[model samples]
Target: MKLSRILKEVKINSIYRTGAKTIKKGGFRKNSNYDPDISSLHYRAQDVQPGGLFVAIPGLFADGHDFIDQARMRGALAIVSQKPVQSDHSVTENISQTKAKQIKNDLTVIEVDNSRKTLAMISAAFFQNPSEKLNIIGITGTNGKTTTAYLIESILSAAGLKTGVIGTINYRYLGKVFENPVTTPESLDLQKILDTMQKEGVTHVVLEVSSHAIDLFRVENCFIDTGVFTNLTQDHLDYHGDMDSYWFCKKRLFTEYLPSGRKKDRAVAVINRENAKGRELFEILPVRGISTGNSADNMIRPKKIEHGLNGIAGNVLTPSGSFDFKSPLVGKHNIENILSAIGAGIALDLSLDHIKAGIENLFYIPGRLERIAGNNGCFVYVDYAHTPDALSNVLGSLKAISQKKIICVFGCGGDRDK
Candidate 1:
């Protein structure tokens, strides 16, 4: 696609303006009509392609205005700055904090109120909106987004669909894996991953949409076919400051911006009914929703729940009827994850039988109730349950089968949940 088309689609209304010193330095594009061969939807100097549009997003820690010089030096043909316009200001003065605030008026920067949201819009435009071409499922919550995302990916893959996944563990597509530190990568990386999946013929994608991602508007323009709320708990309080704010952040995936060109009713919401916040999220859904829980009212309800040494067994009651499934995914929390996956399968038009088959076929998911072997008859399971809700579930699940004392050795992070 052409540079103008990318900018036009993303509503970026500005042209390339080489800085005076940059023009004097000679590597910059002098002409306003000069278009770049490649463009980026983010501000990362490293990720900037030659002739890319660097999105200079100002954050609490540092102003993107500080990095504009570096980006310009690295062949950034244009920049989309998120600075406010001030009436009484001048661009001729040296670039200072005071001066940058003032120059927002006459600069040819594509100014946006929210840079994070703009990045999502630009990424979607650059990637030709790849999320629309695939069945994208977003799993969000304080906990279980990673587990549930991986679980859904496993179930989908077992059903013979070429699926890709993006979560806390990694970004994966057709056996190719890349480590991901952020639970959700920035919008441009996500778009590139989806674009790769699209090229690799991946039909479905299961992505873990974190609250940070939601608050940052990282997925503002992505089309999510189904949004699943696993379970919310006290987490990311350091970032959001309060439970209300955290919940509001997670709610973005289900409530605020969703992809365009799809039927309004097509964006189905799948929620965990056992969780109070998840149940509350269901009420906010404009479209009819499918809920999963261990209780009666849930569309995907678990019955005859039993835990064993190896795994857990349960009969899930779907819209069609009840069916039995046994998975290596232990703990009641994992049962909830199973239900979330079942809800996703049903949303995708798969029958109860196919869903059951898919569930049973998944025997492994790293770090979610993962069993470690030892010489004795003792059972040791490892999990990614740093949050209070997840900790209680893991310990409580083990306590059900524990004849002796159930000792829980744990430690909380210093900076988080403070």
Candidate 2:
């Protein structure tokens, strides 16, 4: 695509063309495009190139603005910054007059209100707006995001849609699966993944939206078709500063990003009414909220639940209809995960039977209530529960099923104030 197209799509404030600084062929000196065409989108200065777009995003430890000189030296043709550049930003600024002039001639700096948001918009545009081509479902909460994401993926696939998933476990679509260090990837990687998914015939994507990702603007413009709120609890307080701030961050998914699209109905929200914050979010959701919980009047609820070590069996009731919900995954806490996924299915307008098929087919999810053999018929299970509420739910569910005394062993991660 042309440089004008990328800038036009984002409507950036300014674009200044600089002189060409040539590089050795097949080496670092190989000059990138002298003009507006961009070969890539990057946030870090180290990754910038002559034709690459470098977004100066402010971070907690280091600020990209401080590394403008490196980006310029690395041949960054287009720079996205929140403010105008200063001559002292680059070490090249103090270089010999000839080198400094050539550096100046080779740079094009664009300023914007928010460089992070700009990176998202430009990344999506650079990837040819791939999110718009797929049905994206975003799940947010302190817990249950990964489980609900798995459930939704299975449901979409059962409906004959090729589904890709972006969650805590990994970002997977089509036949490829790769480890993801973060719950939600930054805009450039996210847009690139969605672009690949679209090309591979993936019709749906499920994303786990973490509070950190939301607050940092990582999920800025990858418009969500459906947003599901599993529940919120005491978590990430240090980073968020308070419970209110934490809830506010999670609320952004329903209130802002979820509603941006041509079809208002497609931008549906699935929330857990049992959660105080979830209920609060439901009221503010841009679309008609699909509230799921034990409440009789909720849009989606479980009429009857039967839990055992084998699995959970329940009659799931939704606005579309009611069906028998069965899953091999254990724990009563997972009931909330199931309900949230059911709401997602309802939002997708999937038939109740398809939802049932999807839920029952998922036999297990790794490191989540995974059962292992123990001596003398004793049972052992592994889980990834860190928060107080999450641990309580897991232990409580296990106690309910086992008549024998239950012993608990857990520890918080290093440096977690909670």
Candidate 3:
């Protein structure tokens, strides 16, 4: 976009113009009112190029400002930063038409109070505000985010909405899937993905928002139409340092970011109230709260769940009505997952028939209770249970169905609290 349009309502802290000394008069636009064309935007200096804008974000380890010379080497058209970056940007031999004509000696540098927040907002502006075109659902908690996201996408898609998903496993849309290294991507990548989804006519997006993503400002400014809190457990204490701090980060999805005052009937917090933390959320959540569990009044309830190592079959009772729900997903914990999915379906205004169809239709979840068989008459299940709560649940389920001795093997990370 034209630099003028990009900066038009964007709040900036300061401005620094650094480059070869091409200035003849006032601001960079003094000579040419036509804004410099910014072809692409990035947060890392390594990704900067001739016509790109680089955002210098201060991180835990290496700070981005330290790499200004590297970005300038690749012809960074503009640099947005929080810390003062005093770089003597040497002249480049090859330059874009806009840069050659608009800037003679210096590069455009816009300083912002908060680079991370500005990166998110600027990305939205550059991408033409894609989140506005899609109904985004942000799911957060210690576990079940990936499974809940898969279940939500399935149900929403069955209801005739073109749905996309961003989860621990992958980011998928329109029959295409991309490998994801994190539960939520950085702000720039996220905006780009949402923009792509909007272009492909995707109407709904389900994202598994991680606590680190929230704390690190990775998901800033992205609109979440609905938020789901699966449940909180003791995990990520190393990063958050305490259970309260960790829970506080997850609560942002429901209390701070979710769309407010839309409708109390259309609940925002889809929670498993059976969990103590989830039950606490049900009491404080503002817009809407849809409880899911075996409780008498859970809007979506799992009654008499019949589950084993092979598969799960159960009765799902929602306020809209009850229906038979079954899934190849193993363990009783999956029953709560089913209830969470059903609650999401209800919140999205989907019919009971579609909800039941979506849950029963999904036969597998990769790396999550995935089953493997051997010819030697033994069964094996692969589960991504890294924390104490998750390991206990998986082992408990396996032991419940084993006719012989149940053996378990697990490990903890080197630096993490065990």
Residue 137 lDDT in candidate 3: 88
Comparing 2 and 3 on TM-score, the stronger one: 2
Q: Candidate 2 or 3, higher lDDT?
A: 2
Candidate 1, superposed: residue stretches over 4 Å from native? 11-42, 84-108, 258-263
Model 1 C-alpha RMSD vs. true structure (Å) is 5.1
Segments of candidate 2 deviating more than 4 angstroms:
9-11, 17-35, 88-105, 263-265, 416-418
Write the residue-wise lDDT of candidate 1 on 226-301 in tens digits.
8888888898778889998888888777776442326345878889988999888888777658998877878889
lDDT of 3: 0.79
Per-residue error for 40 in candidate 2, Å, reads 1.2
Question: Ranking under lDDT, best-scoring first?
Answer: 2, 3, 1
RMSD of each: 5.1, 5.0, 4.6
Give a tens-digit lDDT track for model 2, residues 1-418.
Answer: 5655676556566554333242211111124342456787789989886767788888889888777767777877767888766443452244456656556535666767888888888887788789878888988999889889988988888888899999898888877899999899988888988898899899899999899888877777687888889888989877888888888888888877776654455688888888888888877777878888888878888877999888899798778878887788899989989998888888888988888999998988877888877889888888888887888889999989988997777766754433
Which of the two, 1 or 2, has more TM-score?
2
Residues 360-384 of candidate 3 have per-residue lDDT tens digits of: 8887788778888756787777888
* Maximum-TM-score candidate: 2
Ranking by TM-score: 2, 3, 1
